[model samples]
Target: MSYTFAIIGRPNVGKSTLFNRLVGQKLALVDDTPGVTRDRREGEARLGDLRFTIIDTAGLDEGPKGSLTARMQQQTETAIELADALFFVIDARAGLTPNDRAFADFARRANKPVILLANKSEGKQGEIGAMESYALGLGDPVMISAEHGEGMGELYDAVRELLPEPPEEDEEPEALGELTDEEIAKRPIRVAIVGRPNAGKSTTINHLLGEERLLTSPEAGTTRDSIAVEVVYRGRRFKIFDTAGLRRRSRIEEKLEKLSVADALRAVRFAEVVVLMLDSQTKFEEQDLRIADLIEREGRALVIAVNKWDLVDRQPGQIGALRTEADHWLPQVKGVPIVAMSGLMGEGIERLMKAIEEAYAIWNRRIPTAALNRWFEQAVQTNPPPAVSGRRLKLNYITQTKARPPSFVVFCSRADAVPESYLRYLINSLRSGFDLPGTPVRITLREKANPFAHKRKRPS
Candidate 1:
């Protein structure tokens, strides 16, 4: 197992800022607002040549049982238990408080290696506070500023002392060897479950995981940051990301919510397939449509998951009606797979998984050059290009450039003259002709170079 370090501190002491700096990304949400982080977030951290797993936990504080703050503290305690070492950070500007002192004692009881960090100790202004931290009795305080990237070398040195030595080469040869195709295939499929607020996104994931891996409540927007969890269903591995519910831009007022929305968007971009979970009780809301559109634009394989299906009034042919609505409302992803399931009762989970796998396979599907051109010829012959300025526009040839949302380029006489309507026609035709459904199809028009122009004499 890799060495683990947990960053624990009181509210607004820059523990998250330090975590972001170490992990090299803003995986944890940071804000001027206290308690932005509620759950323990884990990331691979690197410092110089040393790499280890780092856990960023919520601020340690006292609150009544079942309160949000208390749950956050529970998350922090869990991180402390799992970590081999702890970095107890304090705000140098504000100096140590009674809460900080209390948490210091709490860390002491854990009996793990603790490194005191006097963060925001950039100048002489913080010298007094840094001196005062010595009273915590952890060790020499590593004075540094997380925001400005200062004192990392000192931080690295402190962590290295606590971590065990790297395993020798002879210890594990399989780790050194490159992964084969089968091994790669066995790797987890990266999937993100996204939707508007309180759409049972977390509950759906919990049902899939067969445990309450994520905190779920009736309260809208309980999950702030996108949380990723590994799940195995029927021997198939999946890395599922449960993202914060996205609301319309105008309705989002709080800075924290905006940050959460941005984090959810980042999750979509990184995922191979995205499942847009919709609350069946309030199905096809405006925000749900917008979220699905965003997934289509991002070129991720999409699966429309109608969650809370157990509550739906099952009329005859209701499923067919929902499918028809999906195609009509989101024509950009025509024939997209829609699975109706209740996340609360764990109904239709297998169907959801099948849809996700099918979407992923289609997303990665590639067409052969000869077969693609053959379809291209048939398509063009069926519906030829229209006349522009009384001159017939010539479409020379079409070839697929890539997949994962199959992208193609059409070499034609006048690329600029080709209208958006025609491009849409080609895209729709490609989707149908190639049996590529639901996946976003990209078609680019490129003008073929006039090779014989140089050989032709000028009219003048």
Candidate 2:
């Protein structure tokens, strides 16, 4: 488990700067211009002993309901909801404006612990204005100059006091384990949009989010970083990532593009469901398959988005034939969801969301141990483990250890002899019998048979 914190304030107040500071790099676009950062950015942050995820929210501004700024506010609210604590930053030199107070009011009403930060408090002149932070009622202001690199130690102390202990790593089920069907219905679907340069990745993200959180341009590759946004669909929160377009690394020469492509791959690893967005006119490109291969290799749930569908000339049998061919060509990513979407017009986009949700649900599905073993026994009975070097491998049992790309370990006498094709057969069986669709399934063959089931008995 990971603890997360959000740095939020009005525009041009160096929220991005503070974010870059905490994250140890310039992951967020920092500009003096107001609203340069229109979306929330998240990064792995290390604040002293605290190794936690930190979110940089868009600078809030007061605006009318249903307006673009209003949508931005809604995005910020969602961040507050997800985070364990809030770091409300205010410009010390520009002290206690109406907008700052307004944002502070919203933060106060939410009842989360807030650590008030008076940024740009490096000089004696800054100290005079930092004193005015008492008006916000968010507690004693921690002074820091993000650019000049001051007061990080104090910020670390403040965070340690406010936030709860970080969630431990490992796929251990809760003490009250075996979640009911009702609980499954509540888990958020995490989706990552991926493709080559300018495959309408950001456009698709904007359509699903119902607002423009990503900066989209006609340029071939406008998004040079990964941006994550949260949206609620049918009462369930969905964390969506709009990643930088991947270009062939061998062909990519520039310094910045290298970093961007790496960022895109990072997003895929973090995501349970990945949407491989493609231009409908340029369907089934070789590069597309390579991108899909990466997802399959990573063992992630997959959805294929044929974007710009509205622009393409659609014959009745054309799209169907393409999907059929994809199923045949891509065996590793069998049963992958394929949806045609027009990101510009928002047509066919709902199906993409549905496919993503379905894929996510499948990825997180945990097969019961008894049911898994029963299936295992029947599978082995029908097609027994083969003789390798004239020795019949004694396969004992199988158990599904986890989900999020369903993983299983098969306890067998000879782990090395089991061919990849045979493992695929078992994987396919698990997918078909368990009704898990559009998600990667992993099967590991181990020489040891059910170690947890029995204790060793020395010669009696």
Q: Which candidate's TM-score is highest?
A: 1
Error of 1 at 23 (Å): 1.1
Candidate 2 lDDT? 0.82
Residue-level lDDT for 154 in candidate 2? 91
Q: Which tens-of-lDDT digit does each residue in 1-460 have in candidate 1?
A: 7889999999899988998999899898999998888767889888877788889888898889988777778778888998999999999888889998999999999999999999999888687889899999888999999999999999988887887895333333354138764775687889999999999998888888786567787889889989888889888899989899999999999989999999999999999999999988888999999999999999999999999999887889988999999999999999999999999999999999999989998897889989888988888899898989999999988888887778999999999999888888888888888788899888899999998978988699
- Taking all chains together, the TM-score of candidate 1 against the true structure is 0.93
- Report the lDDT of model 1 for residue 345: 95
Best by lDDT: 1
Predictions: Cα RMSD each: 3.0, 8.7
Summing lDDT over every window of 10 consecutive residues in candidate 1, give the lowest-scoring window.
167-176
